[model samples]
Target: MKKTLLALLFGSSLVLAACGDNASDEASDANNPQDAAESAAGTEIEPEKIVNQKCSSCHGGDLSGGMGPALKNIGSQLSEDEILSVIQNGKGAMPKNIIEGDEAEAVAEWLAEKK
Candidate 1:
């Protein structure tokens, strides 16, 4: 009877240990911003960085316009969807697909907030 009790206690301990590990993993995942953003509902692409890397060449570092028209207050001129379309499809003098996928959406979202 003592041996049986010991075995049961050992099994219970192992189960609890496994559960604790899972909980710890979940907590760590929750703490990670990228993981949380990816796991949650919306995409979390960084638009300002994208602009600096890609659009800054044409739009200017300050987005006040260079080769391309000033993007400042572009939100007032175009809706979010329109901005996304332009980024994906491109406008005159702007190359098509200058940005794509989540990057395009991120840029559009960022530009939309410029108003």
Candidate 2:
């Protein structure tokens, strides 16, 4: 009887462990930024698209500078945090709060990786 009880308990514990693993996997999927963005936008959010839509007018189509300063090598000129701050808050002739939230974060991350 004791052996049967032990087997049952062990089986229950294994089932519980499997359940926990599945829950964690679901939670991680939910937390994925790209997945969240795609759900919200009904499509994937491309960082380059955001840049082109919002920045291309002044920065030029290729980010090689036009009315705004060149951004082709901005990654070497500024840290990611600095770039994010400048993007969020604006600097010089740039208007403030041009981008915000996740889109801003994605753009900043993309630009910071240009180097």
Candidate 3:
């Protein structure tokens, strides 16, 4: 019983770790500059930064593929609008609205250029 409990705890930790996003925590803090910047329009959202921070875990650091499918050439398969839809609505293991509003648009635009 003890061993089973330990195994469950370890598995749970891995799952939680994979889903963790420190940037989201910072963005939620009202006092943080990131929150303010994100709220404003035409803020020059950095899509690459968002991808590295928000997507690298699942899509792989280089986006060659990992737990998620290879997105390096996603534009070859999906248009900018389609990509945005997936980001907004999610597909398969991917969750919806990982980043919302202008930030989501920026990332979708950037990824669409990947092809």
Candidate 3 is scored at a TM of 0.73
C-alpha TM-score for every candidate:
0.61, 0.63, 0.73
Instruction: Give per-residue CA lDDT, model 3, range 76-113, as digits (tens).
Output: 99999999999999889776877788888999999999
Clashing pairs in 2: none
Candidate scoring better on TM-score of 1 and 2:
2
Model 3: residue 107 alpha-carbon error in angstroms: 0.5
lDDT of 1: 0.78
Error of 2 at 97 (Å): 1.0
**Model 3 accuracy (lDDT, Cα):** 0.83
Q: Model 1, poorest ten-residue lDDT window?
A: 14-23
Q: Rank the candidates by TM-score, best first.
A: 3, 2, 1
Where in model 3 is the C-alpha error above 4 Å?
A: 1-42
Clashing pairs in 3: none
10 residues in a row with least lDDT, candidate 3: 13-22
